[model samples]
Target: MLAVGAAALVLPLAAGAAPTAFAAPVSAPVLRAPAGGYEELMVPSKMGPVKVQVQWARHGGTAALYLLDGLRARDDRNAWSFETNALEQFANDNVTLVMPVGGQSSWYADWTSASNTNGQKTTYKWETFLTEELPAFLEGYGVSRTNNAALGLSMSGPAALRLAALHRDQFKHASSLSGPLNWNAPGMREAIRVMMLDAGRFNVDSMAAPWSPAWLRMDPMVFAPELRGLPMYISAASGLPGQHDRPAGLGGAYNTANAMGIEVISMVSTRAFQSRLNTLGINAVYDFPSNGTHSWKYWEDQLWKARPHILNALGA
Candidate 1:
């Protein structure tokens, strides 16, 4: 149960050992006729809260795509939610848009060490919340579990793959947009640190900690062995080997900043990690569009592309 830390989650501890509590989400927020022309709902989640948006037929679509957040992405909104007019995309189709509210930088792991004591932490019991709580709620709300898949961007990329990989019964399709799948690399870590610092949201304890053996154990790549048969859909920007802006030459043949000694963790190519997947016979579908970068524009397009895969996974 170490992986399932209890009582430590932010909860109230009364003198009489009573429970701590937050007013349970009475009425989740939903905005119909979105400004961008979609139905939007700011729903509560175990991780915290999510903003669920739908842009399909009025029949309450059967298939779903659970969108995840990046390290700096906020639960309040998303790149697609803020920018695109998703409602226009589903005028002819039926699909449910489910965005779980939290996990910025969470890497979407069943985090064994990131809860609050006494359910008091703003961060809720997410893994349980997502896999069980949220799913049940959605089912009640008319979402069919039999036709649900997940897709995320950047930091959430690995998670999208992991969820489907680890729980094929629940999620048959998963995808990531501009995500750094091989976080075990040095250059990738540094790039992340730089982004964290720039975003002013970098917390060593929050990002990765030696004290929390849970972090490593939660990583998807490390546990890919447990995830088989789940189809993976990936889209990422191209760049240097996990490291960007590398100085190169003929002798540059042997240079690597990704401490793991991955011959070349290509930011421009999904080489390193894909090779491993190839070995495991898990390369379902991957794309390294020569034009995309690790940015919002690329992800928007990537999400659009992954939508078909999401539908396929949902068997819709």
Candidate 2:
């Protein structure tokens, strides 16, 4: 009788908490069509309010695609919008484009702790934000919480695969463009530390202790088996310069060289990830272009190529 009365008393209090918990989201701006353009949103998160750019489906479709940015993501706009013609290319697609801005050096992962460096004011809870907070709010906009896709380039490439693997119920299609897929590889931790430091002086230790279970949890290769039967598009380019690399001066030459080296690493890592998937009997589309570099041009091309597959997977 005591247990029964306790349950009955808790029901009303629990019901009361629901409105309080969802009060902020209830007050959030609604998704309104802007006459065939992008609509900006401020999604509430534990880290803070995050700015997200959205392009509603041209034909009023509900399927959404999340495009994650690189390590040096900017606060003003997502690279997919400014660096590439992704917005224009997908303007008429029957899928919503969700691009989150401002996550410099954050590999779209939940960090262990908040860093006080590089103007980081809150703990990076990106995984939680994407999977939990953002999805719940998007449901209000007629988007299916489960029927969505995720794609990323460079640093966020592995993150897209990892998110899809771990949260299979949320993401139906996943793609990686020029992403370093192997996180536990030798020297990766140190390399990531240097890169993160250079990007925004972020401390890699805050992401996860080197090689710890937390860090390993973010590796796409470590969770390759979980991606079995999921639609995946993996692409990488050779370090050689392609039509996109036009060296103009010393600065252009240096940039091209840097892109070449980065592309080489990405190609090797993507190949290893493919091999791991093969061992697991997982099938995925792989694009190993003959000659290219780790630049927006190559990534832009990959995005175009992956669109049909992504649409097919989402039934959009």
Candidate 3:
């Protein structure tokens, strides 16, 4: 029974193996201006000031995408920031890139009673932040806010949908790659436990007691009814390779083991969460990449693939 922290901290995602004995920092060329656009912004967050930096190729068009991060992904660098170069890939695609920063493990939810607002307990209000705050603030850049899409990796997968589901009028499309679709599942509790414990923030006694509802309240499945009518793109690396060094020998029996062991990310109890999305009558561009795992390689490919479909949904 670890004591949950009074000050919740989000552990960042894996970035190019830290200055290590084997791998060096990913060296990619800078996203040049004139052909690409870049900006480092300080946006307001429920926790504190957030710094968002983005670079994208400049092409003429109305396509836009918003990206969020996972718990282990930090503001400093994540798979995309340190390993994969985003601006280099989409610079000439005529798509506008919008990134709102500082949500490592925050789940991009609007806190109802966790954050501080007007000397009162408040919700993180992430919904308002992305849908209303950031868009309104970035409107000065001559970018259209009409039918933008949201893309996220890991924990942010659901966040992307939560945004679109809650504010469908604002986002024309939603896409999640390598994200945990079922948070309420029994299999999820262990991962969540490991995550909270590793971060020195765990309290089983408080599970679903008080503030816990806020977390589940933000899960997309809870809002599935609203999410069903939207155009979505979902992908996972099913029957895929595992993470870096995880093996089939390490008792790959537990949910976490299978998740980190093989590259295939799935639910043991309900393996077809992706297919279930189809059953809901929402048209989706779904891909179960062969031998894929939870890594930047999968994310980069998934985002690149989902680009056109999303843009078209936005009427770009």
Candidate lDDT values, in order? 0.53, 0.81, 0.58
How displaced is residue 87 in candidate 1, in Å? 4.0
- Over the stretch 198-280, how does candidate 2's per-residue lDDT look in tens digits? 66688889989877988989888788889998999999998799998898899678767777777788888899999999988
Rank candidates, lDDT, best first.
Answer: 2, 3, 1
Segments in model 2 whose C-alpha atoms lie over 4 Å from true places? 1-36, 116-119
> What is candidate 2's TM-score against the reference?
0.89
Highest lDDT: give the candidate number: 2
Q: Among these predicted structures, which one has the highest TM-score?
A: 2
How many pairs in model 1 have backbone atoms within 3 A of each other, for residues 3 or more apart or on separate chains, i.e. clashes? 20
What are the per-residue Cα lDDT tens digits for candidate 1 across 1-316? Answer: 1111111111111001222333333244332212222445545565445555444434556566677765555544554555444434544556666655445445666544443322324533445555676666666556666667888765667777767765666777878765556656545545544444433243434445642565555555676666567767776555233333232774333222221122122242245667767788775688876543344445566677766776666665
What is the Å distance of residue 193 in model 3 from its true position?
Answer: 3.8
lDDT score, candidate 3: 0.58
lDDT of 3 at 275: 51
lDDT string for model 3 (141-239, tens) is: 544567688888766887888888878778888988877676665445555555544432433223333326656666556666787768888877764
Candidate no. 3 TM-score: 0.74
